[model samples]
Target chain A: MEVNDELVDKIAALAKLEFKGEEKEAIKGDMQRILNFIDKLGEVDTEGVEPLVYMTDETLKLRADEVDQEISQDEALRNAPDKDSDYFKVPKVLKK
Target chain B: MYTSFEQVKREIENGKTVEDITRNYLETIKEKESLNAFLEVFDQDAIEQAKKVDEKLKNNTAGKLAGMVIGLKDNICYKGHAVSASSKILENFESLYSATVVERLLEEDAVIIGRLNCDEFAMGSSNEHSAYGAVKNPHDQNRVPGGSSGGSAAAVAAGLCLATLGSDTGGSIRQPASFCGVVGLKPTYGRVSRWGLIAYGSSLDQIGPLTNTVEDSALILEVIAGSDQKDSTASTKKTDAYSTASKFEGKVKIAVIKETFETDGLDPEIKKNLEERIESLKEQGHTVDYVSLDILDKLVPTYYVLSNAEASSNLSRYDGMRYGYRSERAEDLESTYVKSRTEGFGTEVKRRIMLGTFVLSAGYYDAYYSKAQKVRRIIREKTDEMLRDYDFILSPTTPKTAFEFGANDNDPVSMYLEDIFTVHSNLAGTPAISIPAGFHSNGMPYGLQIMAGSFEEKKLLGFARTLTE
Candidate 1:
C-alpha cells in the first residue's frame, strides 16, 4: 500500500507529533518502505493460528492489592521540568 | 586488564582491595573516553560502594559480585541516577526507584559504574542514533559498536566495566555483543524481570548481560534472573545455578538453520566462519545438521510490526507534562503534546512511532498488527519444534561484522535487516547467547548464536560454555 502524505499526517496527528513539509515527506518515504516490508506477512498461512499476544503460556499472576512500594511525593516530582506543590504542572489543559 | 570477575575476585583474595579495582577501572575509563562508552561514570558513588564492599570482604560478608563493576544500558533504572534510554525526551531524568535488576545487582555488591549510551529509546541497529553521539568501535574507530546496547558492549569490550546489563528486544543485546566481540546473553523472555526497564516492545523486551566471557555472562544472569513481585511476567520458576552448574557433558545435537546460510546479503566471510565453526563442532564429535525454517523471512517483518506497535503505545507517556524535556513552544495542552514530542524525540524514534501508528491505525489493524501476531505464533511454534529435536539451534548472530558509521543510514530497511538472524530468540521467547566465534579477514569479530528451549537457561549456558570452549 502507498504511504501517502495524508496517511503520514493522519498517523503523525494520532501520535501527537508534528512534522515540517520535507520531514513529513521523508518520513512518508520511510513508512512506505517499512509498510511494504511488513506487508510480506500477507504471504504467511496464519490459518488456525492463535495470535501470540504474550510470549509465554503462563497467565498473569495477580499480586494482592497492598501498599508494597512507592516513592515519596517529593521524589515523584523531582524530575519534572515544570511542577508546583507536588503537582506536575503542564500547559493549561483547558483554555483560559 | 581484568578479563573476568573470577580474576577480579582472585586479586582481591591476594590482599588487593575492591577499591583498588574500582580505581583501576576508573583510570581505564578515563583513558578510553574517546570511545564514548559510558554516558556518566558514578565515580564517587562507585568508590563509596567499593570501599563498603572492602569492609564486607574484611568481615567475610561479601556477596557474589563484590568487586565486579557493571554498566547500565541507560534504559535500566537506578535510583536517583539519570536513565534516559539515550533519548532527548528524558535527558537528565533521574529514576525514582531502582529497577529490580539494579536492586538485585547492588544487593550482591556489584558496583554500578555508570550508564552507557544506546540508540535513542533503544531503536537503532547502529549506535549513531544516540543523542549524545555515536559510540566508536574500540576495534576500529570508524566503524560502529552495534546497537541498541552499543555502549554496553563497547564498555565490556574496552574493559570499561567487567560486564553490563542490556535489554534485548529484537537483538538489542545480542547483536551489539556480537559486534563488540563479547559474550551477550538474552535469557528467556521472562527469565529476568523487566520491572524497571524502559519498555520498547513490552512483550519482546528482556534484560540480559553483556560480558567479556561466557562465564561472566552466566554469573551476572545468576544474580539477576528470577521472579519479581513487581513484574507479573517474571518467571515463577526457580532460578538456576547458572555460574556453578555442570556444563555440557557430552557430544550434543546442533541444528543449523538452513536459511541463514542461504539468506541473501549475508557477508561471505561470516558465512565461511560459520561453516568452519560447524566443521570444528562436527570434528569434536557433535552431531550437526541443517534444519528447514520456511518462515525465516517473516521473522523481521513480524518483529517490526509488533515491536513498533507496542513501542508507539509504550512511549506515548513521554509528554511535556511530568518529567524530562518540555518544549518551550508549548502554550496549551495539545501543542504541549505535539510540539514537545516532535522536538524531544529524534528522527528515527519519530519514524518508528509514525510507522507504529500507521499499522495500528483503524483501517489497517487486521492486515498488519493482528496478522503479525498470528505469524508470531507460527514463528514460536516452529522454533520450539526445532528445539525439541535438537539440543541447540545455531546461527550467526548477525548478517555481518559491524559496518562503517554511515553505511546504512539512509536505508532503514538495510539497518533493520542487520537484526535478521538475532531476532529469532526474542520471537520464540527462548534463551540465546552470542559467543564470539572468531574474527573475519577484515580483523572484525563475528559471533555464533546458540538458542535453546524456553526457560532452559541451565542447558543453554552449558551449551554456550561448551561452544565457547
Candidate 2:
C-alpha cells in the first residue's frame, strides 16, 4: 500500500497516461485505492465456478464482408485535432 | 394534475399538442438545472417529434407512448445527435445510427427530449467522473444521483421525462433508480438489444427503462424489448407482452437473501426499510422466505473483475485512428493506440482497463481472468438453483440513498460498495426491478429490488407494482 514513484510510473505506462510530477502522485493514490478494492476479490472461493465472459446465451453473428461507402479522406480528417493534407500529424519519432 | 403515466397518456390523447407537453417538461428541466440531470435538451427535435405524434393521434394512429417525452442516457445512441457518454473523447461525435431501443421507441412515437448525463462510459458509481459534470440527486441537489445511470433516474424523478432508457452493466440502472425513487429494470441479458449502445463492459450491459411506475416500465419494456437482427445477442424468442401484468393474478412467494442483508456495509435505515417491505409482502398473503446465497459476499469483486476484463478488451477498439478525439501527437501505431486510450479514458476507466490487461496478460490469465469466470458460473448456478423454490428474490436496491457528491471520491472501494445489493442479478443474468419502498430519515427515497428468473421480467414487474402499491 506504500505507493512510491517507480510503481506509479509503471502503472501509468500500463494505462498509457501522460502525467507530469504531481499528477503521478495523485494517480498513485487513486490506484492504491482501486488495488485495495481488487484485493477483496481474493476473499471469494471461485474454485469450481465458470467465469462468465459475456451475458448473452447467443453469439455474435458476423456480417458479410462487404465494402461500405467510404468517406472522403478530407471528411474523415475534418475533426482531427492535428492533421496534414494527406495524413494525421504527430510528434516526430524515428529521428530528429 | 397528471402525476401518473395513465394521466399523461389520457390527457395527451384528448387533443393536446405534443409540443405543449414537451415544452412544459423542458421548462421544468431548465428550472431544475442544479441537478445536472441532462447533458443537452433537444427542445426543437422533441417538439418536432411530438408534433408528428400529435398528427398521428389526430389520425387515430397513436402508438404506445405517443407524445411522451423520454430522456436517453448520453451513452445510448440517437441518430444525428451527439452521443458523448459524458466523456471528452466522444464530445463532438454525432451518432451515425440510433440504438435499437431508441429506434423502437421512436417507432412507438415516443419523443426523445434530451440526452441525460452519466458517468463517462458508464464507468463510475457516483456519477462524479463524468467529463461534463456530476448529476446531483433530484431529491437533494447536494447528493449524487447514483450512477452511471444517474441522469436517467434523476430525470424521471424530477418529471423531466416520462421515462428514460439506461444501460445497466452491473448495478448502474437499479442503484440510481434506488437513489432517485423510481422504478428501474435490468432485463435478462439479451431481453433488450444493445446495438448502437456504446459498449461498456459488453457482457454485463443491458438496456432497460426507468419510470415513475412499474407498469410504465413494463409498457416501455414491451415496446423496446425483444429480438433484433441488428444485435445478434438479442434473444431469439418472440417479445412476450410485458404489460400483461396488468391482468396478472395470484400471490407470489419471494426469498430475501439473508446474507446480503447481514453484510457489514448496509445502512441501518435501508435495512429497516427492507424489513418493512418484506413484512408488507407477507401481509399481502405472499409467502416470504429467508434464502441464503452463501456466496453472496463475492458479488462485487467478481463483478468488477469480469466486467473490467471485458471492458478492457471491448474498449480496445477505440484508438486515435478509427474513432472520435484522436490525439495530436503519436509516434507510431502502438503509441497512438496507447496514448489515445490513456488520454481519452478517465482515471477509474484506466484503472479497470489496467486491471483487466494485467489479469488477461500472459502469465496471469489463469490466475485472474479464468478464476473470475469460474466464480461467475458458480454465482449463476447457485442463483438459478435458488430460484426453483422461490418465485422471486428480494433485496435492498442500494445500501443507502444518495450520498454527497465526492463523498467517496478519496475511496473508490467505498463507492463500489454502493452496488452491493444489486450486483447479484447481473451476475446471475436474471431480470430485476427496483421500486421505491419508502424514504430514509434524510428524506430521500430508498428502493427494494425484486429479481426473477430469465424472461420473468413481467413477473418481477408485477410483484414490484404490488409491493409499491
TM-score of chain A of each: 0.88, 0.78
TM-score of each predicted structure versus truth: 0.99, 0.93
Worst 10 residues of 2 chain B by lDDT: B321-330
* Residue B338 miss distance in model 2 (angstroms): 4.4
- What is the C-alpha lDDT profile of model 1 across B1-469, one tens digit per residue? 8888889989988999989999999999999999999999999999999999999989989899999999999999998898899999998798988999999999999999999999999999889999999999998989999999999999998999899999899999999998989999999999999999999999899999999888888888999999999999998889989997566879899999999988879999889888988999899899999989999999999999999999999999988888888999998989989999999999999999988888899989999999999999999988989989999998999989999999997889889999999888888999999999889898888898989999888898888887777
Instruction: Please give the interface root mean square deviation for model 2, in Å.
Output: 3.2
User: In model 1, what lDDT does residue B449 have?
Assistant: 92
| Poorly placed runs, candidate 1 (over 4 Å) | none
Prediction RMSDs, each to the true structure: 1.0, 2.6
Q: What DockQ results do all the predictions give, each relative to the true complex?
A: 0.86, 0.44
**TM-score of the second chain, cand. 1:** 0.99
Candidate 2: C-alpha RMSD after superposition: 2.6
Name the top lDDT candidate: 1
Task: Specify the highest-DockQ model's number.
Answer: 1
